[model samples]
Target: MIQFMLVDDESIIVDSLHRLLEGQEDLPLKVWKAYSADEALDLINIIEKTEGQGIDILMSDVMMPGMNGLDLSALIKSRFPELKTLFLSGYSDYTYLQTALHQEAFDYLLKPVDDETVIEAVRKLCLIIEEERRLKEQEKQNGMRLKQAQRMLNDELLRELLEKPLTPQQLADKEESYVQASLSVDQCFILLNGKVDQWPLTYTEIEKMRQREMIMELMVSMLQPQCSIVPYNGSRHLVWLLQVKRMDHDSETCDLPQLHWYLSEELERVQFTIQERMGLSCSFVISGHEVDWLQIGDVNRKMGELLDRAIGLKSEIMQVEQAGEAMSRYQDIQLQPQEIKKQLLALTGLLEAGEFLAFMNELRSFFETIRKSVFLTYERQSEIFITLAGLYLSYMNSRQMTTEVGMKLDLTYLTNFNKHTDWQSFGDYCVRLAEILFLIVGDDAKEQKQEIAEKVDNYIIQNLSRNLTLQQLADHVHLSKFYLSRLYHSQRGYPIYQKIKEQKLNRAKELLLQDDIKIKDVAAELGFENVPYFTTFFRNSLGMSPKEYKQSYQS
Candidate 1:
């Protein structure tokens, strides 16, 4: 039975209400009676401490001696926030009290209340409490089921099955979760890996979350009824285990070569659709043969190896068989694919960080990536070496020194990836270029030029009253007048002299604004030859003399 409390200043009223409520077995309430608010509060403290619960309903008179119904209700609610309160007030008191209090509900019975009205109000509150209990129980059960579903449906389970040799029980778990029903029939799964070339740089975390879901939905639309699992573990990559929906499987099962082409073509549509709809340059590498459930780990590793090389590469699509040269070369030795991938991927970062020693150490494995690349054309390879040489030479001249790097080592490999015909000699020359980047300490010559241009503008502004010449500006940033002029023009797209003239003109007009300052004084303050020279300069810029411009402003 739910607990109830009744409070009134009169002893007879409290006693009558308590007996009246307790008699209704259907509404079943254990009623507590109190003649005053203080007595009601004292009884509540005992019930809370002893029964480990609070009163479910509290009904009290609005106007009493020490504490009225409104004040008592607020005090009890602070302890038990969900406690339901009903006020006992006359018609005049109820009208005024209703506006003063706004709790979860403003419910009450008027003074001289009938017995049926008291029973009905308490009955309604009990039903509401019971319904809330039912919903809370339902939500708890649903939450447990959702957690179990998330564990079963996540990509971790898919990865574990593909990457490790599972125990029989583990195998049974995978089967029960996704494969048990299909065990009676023949099935083919193609492993396809996709990498988003660049996530939208401008997207906020919330927008990117929505974009990922939309892209996955697009992929599922094309592959469903054929796809068993696609678990994207919130990486830059998406891995799908696509079960081929083949009708004529009897002959197609043996034709692994033809099957490879067919499966890859189907997966390519997913790539094309995402590229078109989402505007993300995604690269993919499909498994070249039908994947056996037991042999999944082997295929996954090979695909991962090829993907590692293709990841930083532009919109590249390939299969295992396409990289025949690298595969054949590796057969003669343990290729250490992971090491080669790290060496290749590290070049851009190593160069940026100016890590000369690290570059030299990894040069051997670095060359291995270029030599083993199936997609890099001879022209592209030549361009790669040329670009590296240019970066080093550019750094050398950034510090005003142009020195030839190689005498003994052949530099022709700097023209082409295979030109020197000797890896050690080529690497030796490249090491010298790496040395240039390390020693300079300043990366990106463009950024260095921008800094020089900014300093020129600041110097001209700060020393405007002095000799604000091009030579002085160049001297400020430690560059020659000729080179500084060229550098500033490259960054700002205007001549340095034009910039100085504009600054002097703007300053002349500003200084001329003061009523106490004369034209001659303004000219001297702006580093002009005389008032005549400053007047000529101002008239040429604004088609008005400085005196006339100041008068126009004053008007």
Candidate 2:
């Protein structure tokens, strides 16, 4: 029901309208009265201050002391645009109607006012206010949706820029409204050209490209090196600009040869895994020492020539001037079929058997030949990769990384997963990586285990209503209940049961802050049969009960 105020100079008129409005059922108006325009002014001031919002409707008489109804309506309208106004005047005065029009009054009733007329005017006023409120709410929602869509589009545009070189105008246009520019210097050009189509990862090129960027980002961060990477040559080439403090050629800090070697080694490792796990074929170019962005065109041309030569000879990494040296270095390498058999056998051995290290050495030797081969056979690569991964996992299991350490290899959850193709080599690489990871982390297993625990902690959140339990999760990952319990305590330094209780209490605090759901319901949903138990738990953890938490949010 809409609340309304009745104002007139006559007590009789005010009394009559108040009785009439109070008695009404359809409009169900809650009417208050004032005897004169001066009195009405006092009442309006009090209500606006106390309520901190305008009254829905103001009904005033035209002739009331010094200030008339039209004047009052104008003052109220200026302060509250949404407020509706009505005037009462006698004798059907044109002057009164004109004054009301100037005031932008909602409507005017001729004296003496009828009960039906008042009810209808109030009804119309209420509908107008409701419609305005709904429109404002819809506008707010539309604004939020527009913001979300804009952010998504911005992310997609940035991704596209990374995959291919855009002209200055295209780059500027893509980031026109969203990005802030930053300064950079030093650059190199890399051209990826070869029979890439022959690789098993035909469909995962974009993903691989993203993965490459990620490796670059992390590597650059560690090096504290200033570098900017842009895609060039229709997504088949890369332009990199790296800046550093000037240093002697022999200093590791700015030694181009050393830096190139380090980056090349890491890329080679990733490439090998991509082949073993994803069954993808790719070729890359590394700009020669002293090359800078100023030489991009020249480097690109030379890189293309090298790529063509490598494709002709069947190789993945080609140096335009150092082909003879690379071939000589790798020529004597051969497939270690015996080492391959040994690694497969070690997958069944225990951690204490020392077979894992031997297996790694064997793989390194065996891959020497395959690594240099231009015609990388996916089938052959996949078999070796799968066997190596199985062996790695065996070592991880023997060392109890999964059980005592609570470290599970979550390859799919990694952000890098979206950047690569689902190639056989990549798949094999992931499996083998997981295996060797469990073994390699053995050196600092405690620290690594703690990090993995933190990641899992973030995943749990404070949704106590969820069915998150150790036994359930253990079954999902094919681990025993005992192992899961021990690992949770060892790695996270907390009992599983305690973690669940803490999560539930946190959620209860969030619900209490909302002031919508009742405290009892929040308690019930967090697995508490009694509301008192939830209050006690919350009080214990936060030093205040749920009621106190709700008050803090309100205050």
Candidate 3:
């Protein structure tokens, strides 16, 4: 409804206008009368005090004593912006309209106003005000919905990208601000093999997990300017990814083993001090292979097997078997291969016998020996095979791979494992994987490294739309940290990560150019949450706003 307040010095003028306007109902206006400008000011103050409840229109005579109608209109405009005003004066001069415009008055109502002009002005003012209000309301609603959606997407993205465990609500509340950069970011994951057990599963265990995660997060934070860490798999398992780690700086000063020990100690402390706490026993398995996040199901399924077989040992040495050769050929010592094979064969037997404790112990020993052998580079391919086997065993132990997830892990024709320069490493990794599976294993550490690179690259490209990292990729393709890094850099010229970013950016550009789509839609399509950041990235890459760039192309 359009409401009005009428103020004039002459009571007769106010009375006449009130009576005439009272008869009108088509123009949604409710009018009030005051004999003087002072009375109008008081009424306005009361309405303002009432929080804009009843009043919408102000019709006042110009040229009143003390506080003139122009001054009152200006005052009302400064405070009650939504109150539409009409200046009523006997004089028809440009001065009043100019002042009325300055105060943003709706229109000028000439003195001794005719009912027709008054009705028409009121009707027009009401229409304009309502339309403006509607637009503002719509804009507010849109902004709110955008914010909500952004929160949801960011939470999901960060959870996967960071490998951190966060609830949807917590993600919605977290502020995810980005660091502006022209250099593309390559996601990197570090998988550490550690078992944290407390005697009693209490809040203390949770706290211990939190502390360990925090320590790891802090260490990674030092490695990279931005990083995320989170608990995975029953809070005992942890996953970390690099957001923007300084490779050069970390390589120069980073002491990874020391950092690992620090986290281990924190884990131990919680176990010792807290009731029902068991100490944390951990093994370090780091990889920097690039793969997509969606493909993790496959990579993890394979890598989990690696982690499983890497722990626990019945033998002094863990050997990487070559394909098509007797396991005895790969044995370093007379009894080493036989003893390892015996233990491997016994694992399923023990599990079937319901020997959980012994199973865990054997598993732990296998990983310890595997870790020691994996870091050694007597034959680089052997190391790679051992690494792949360990990762596969880890997944097999975890048992997260379902038939649906298995579909993504299949080696296809696109996986060019034969072209790798580290053919020995590729062969070794494959043989080791076969060994982990208890398949017939021979050690032929004579595979090309380029073939390994090709297979890994193919997997990355196939799953580019997901959140993935080098660590996961390395584990999937079964290459050691050192071998994968050397091969990726040697083959790709730049890091394998640069290609991932270029691919994503290319897709983003194509989406931005599409028509009849909201900028928010573009961000969602590219798996970004904040549209503003998407806008910033688009502008930085294309040298103009997305909207402007699209329009330029259209023209």
Predictions in order: lDDT:
0.62, 0.54, 0.50
Q: Can you give the TM-score per candidate against the true fold?
A: 0.37, 0.26, 0.26
Question: What's the ranking of the predictions by TM-score, best on top?
Answer: 1, 2, 3
- The regions of model 3 sitting more than 4 angstroms off are 48-54, 144-555
TM-score of 1: 0.37
Better of 2 and 3 by lDDT: 2
| 229: Cα error in model 3, Å | 40
For model 2, the superposed segments whose C-alpha errors exceed 4 Å read: 26-28, 144-555
Q: What is the C-alpha RMSD of each candidate to the true structure, in Å?
A: 26.8, 26.8, 31.6
Candidate 2: residue 166 Cα off by (Å) = 34
Per-residue lDDT over 9-42 for candidate 2, one digit per residue giving the tens place of the 0 to 100 score: 8765577678767776666456768877677668
Clashing pairs in 1: none
Answer with 1 or 3, whichever has the higher TM-score: 1
Which candidate, 1 or 2, would have the higher TM-score against the true structure? Answer: 1
